[model samples]
Target chain A: MYAWFFRELLPGPLWVRIILTVVLLAAVVYGLMEFVFPWLSEYSPLGDVTLEDG
Target chain B: MTPPLPRHADPAQRSVAAATRRQRRRRPLGAKIMGGFGEILITLGVLGLLFVVWELWWTGIEAESDRQDSLDEFYANMPARPAVSDGDDGDNDDDGPNPADFEVCYTLDDGTEIGCADHMRAQTGSEQIMGTVYAPRLGENWAAPIRYGVSATQIDRGGVGHYPNTQWPDEPGNFALAGHRNTNASMLGNQDSLQIGDPIYVVSYDGIYVYEVRERQVVLPNQTEVLNPVPSDSAAEAEFGVLTFTTCHPMFSNRERLIHHAEIVDFVPIGAEAPADLVHHEPITQMFYAGGAG
Candidate 1:
């Protein structure tokens, strides 16, 4: 899937493709960090810092 | 010889080409499957690692920014200190503004004054900044704004949060606050470093309430008795106010809560000199002295 994405989905020459890949990767990581991860953290126990009454 | 017989024009040559193509199409099914599976696994691994980075690092960045905004808003809304002239130093012998000079901002339901503790009952769900907390023992510049709610909307902003049901500072009850231990700017990241008798200063709009650490314990999340009017003793009436700090225990885990209780030792109303022990974080202490307001 990734190979297909890199080889076919992206356009341009090798150098342009490489830069595009970096940019795309950065956008994905930024989205995950700013949106997906924070929302997922709500359900994850990893960042549960508050206590509750029994 | 004649243009290589136009390759495909010859039936024999066409058959040979077709056979190779068939072989190429028939081979590597298993390898393709395994390769795809490995790619998926690698993608999942990278995503998991990124999630950890988000939790440990990215969250702090966002929270710190939020905390800064909260601090700025709190200071901006703070009442300006009474002005003093340099040449009139002899007339004003006191070091700073006198607490007695400021009007009371909070009182109990029965109209009894709560003094410099600034025991204002915040409306539920209003995530307002209640005060700024400073602990010299925690760090020379360690300070976090305490907000009204303990939920993520408040605590995740890189500051301590007051449990809604808990009492306010110097209110003759337990004033409980919560903070993240390892994430969200780790406001109380060094909570365990507190020592017995260490001073924790809570600077509210009315004044600074000084609390001295009295005890520390690890308790299950449900052991909320620590937030009782009289911590761990619901039956007993609180004779004086106490401060409680609650955070997730064992550093990176939230299986339990690390609790610290501090007794309110003194109160210095706004305009008065903060307790000598209070760490002088300029942005915080400046709000109390003349010309400190912006």
Candidate 2:
């Protein structure tokens, strides 16, 4: 299914398609880092420590 | 059956054809399994690299901008400084009034530089930028805002967070702070680098609290005594204001915390010349004025 989709959706020759795939992967990584992960970390309680200090 | 060959095919072409045939041969089951495992390992490695970039680079970028915005807002809302005329006491210095004469001012032990503890004692708020901290040992350009809490909302903004229950800057107690070592901006990424007698300056709206590193220790995250007025010396009475900086230890791990303790030794009020340690750091001086209430 993925092979058929790529063959139909991707443009140009094999080298062009390879470059396009790499670009798409990079975009995915960037989106995850820029938005997705930050948003997810908001719910994390990692650094949320309150010390009723002595 | 004989396979068809090109009319111009030569001995070299025949060898190439044989090599192509050999390349088409199927791999053994064990080899195929190993290749699949190798591909998975490579995929995992790529994912790990992406995570590292997200943690170090992207987070730093976000936090820096957030810190800048917070500082801008804090500076904009600062109350104007009250005018103090130079008296005819034969000392007409342009560096504002002498702390000895002013009720709001308190001098350090040297009786020269004024303390800001009295000024900062009146200000308090949550998620607010208290002041800028400078540690030359951290780096020449190292300065982080002291926020009100040790949560994602504060620390993730690329600055250290002051423990809410702890004492304020120049206060006669422990003014403890926490930061990340490998995430966000990693404000205290080099907390372990601070050595004995190294200076750590905490600049509030009132003045710069100059602290000298006295000791370093690693402790568990839940060890609350480290935030005490005397720090781990619970039975001992507090004599002077102490500063504690905490961060995740071992880099990229959080199993333990690295803590550094410094004692407030001096205070340089606004309009006065910055301390000697800050002489080489002009940007800090610039930032101090930019955020100054005066």
Candidate 3:
């Protein structure tokens, strides 16, 4: 399945396709770690330890 | 390739390719939607786990190292204390510390009683190490540096914070302190374990202030009275030095504040031998002077 997908979808040789896949995976992980997760964490109550009293 | 078979690639191969393409294109709408939703959920889960690791574990490691570095610098530059022969047995005949021995602060109106903390604070300015807090209940080696104010920069550095306006150690008022309950090294993570009469030692360059736990209370965050000269008794007069420990309650949650109050029972001068219970638990970096055991 992977071979078929890479062969049909990617416009490059096997080596180039492999490199593209790795770079794409890295980009997605970086985006989630650096941006998406941090924005979501602000809404999480786990790290919000401050008191509510004025 | 034997001359290309007109447009239909050999009936068998052509049929198989068409069937595969049809199956790929004919995925059910409900299945597609479910698959997309599942992917979203998995991504959310992975992100949540990563955040947990960052907040609970990575932050702790970073804060601990920062605090350790601060402690090392603070201790290394401390001046050597003057020797006093009578510090070892804990028996001094003077009604109060020798005026010539250390700077004294007459916080009360009488001007007779001396507050050693006034001297210590004067000696150690803002953002400096006010002292070292040792809680045997926390651990055999639980000692955190006490900085000047309560803020993320200070408390998050893996140490407790001393209220700026509150009384200093040995002062005839409350020496209030604050620390994190969970994140940033959680200096006071186990503060609730302190039992009544448990000795809480505050070690300064000048001397050690020993406070005995007398009570514990949970209060609202807005209740500033807990830090008053006399905790929860704003109008009541203060007679002796007291220590108060404040932290977020319920461990990981911060819906309430946990407070522990201790009364000063003794003061050990710089030259005195260290307290037996606190001897084993030294700072990560030790700065021993030629004149005293501190």
By TM-score rank, best first, the candidates go 1, 3, 2
Candidate 1, residues B196-251, lDDT tens digits: the string is: 99999887776777788999999999888888999879999887778999999988
Taking the tens digit of each residue's C-alpha lDDT, what string does model 2 give over B141-202? 67787777786777888878888788776546899998877777678878888999999988
Docking class of 3: acceptable
lDDT of 2: 0.71
All candidates: interface RMSD: 1.4, 4.8, 4.0
Which regions of candidate 1 deviate over 4 angstroms? B1-27, B84-97, B101-119, B122-127, B277-279, B283-294
- Candidate that would win on lDDT: 1
Candidate 3 C-alpha lDDT tens digits along B7-53:
64676776566567666677687977877788779877976777776
In order, the first chain's TM-score in every candidate is 0.85, 0.72, 0.68
For model 1, the docking class works out as: medium
Candidate 3 wrongly placed segments (more than 4 Å): A1-53, B1-26, B81-100, B106-115, B122-127, B281-294
Candidate 3 Cα deviation (angstroms), residue B60: 0.5
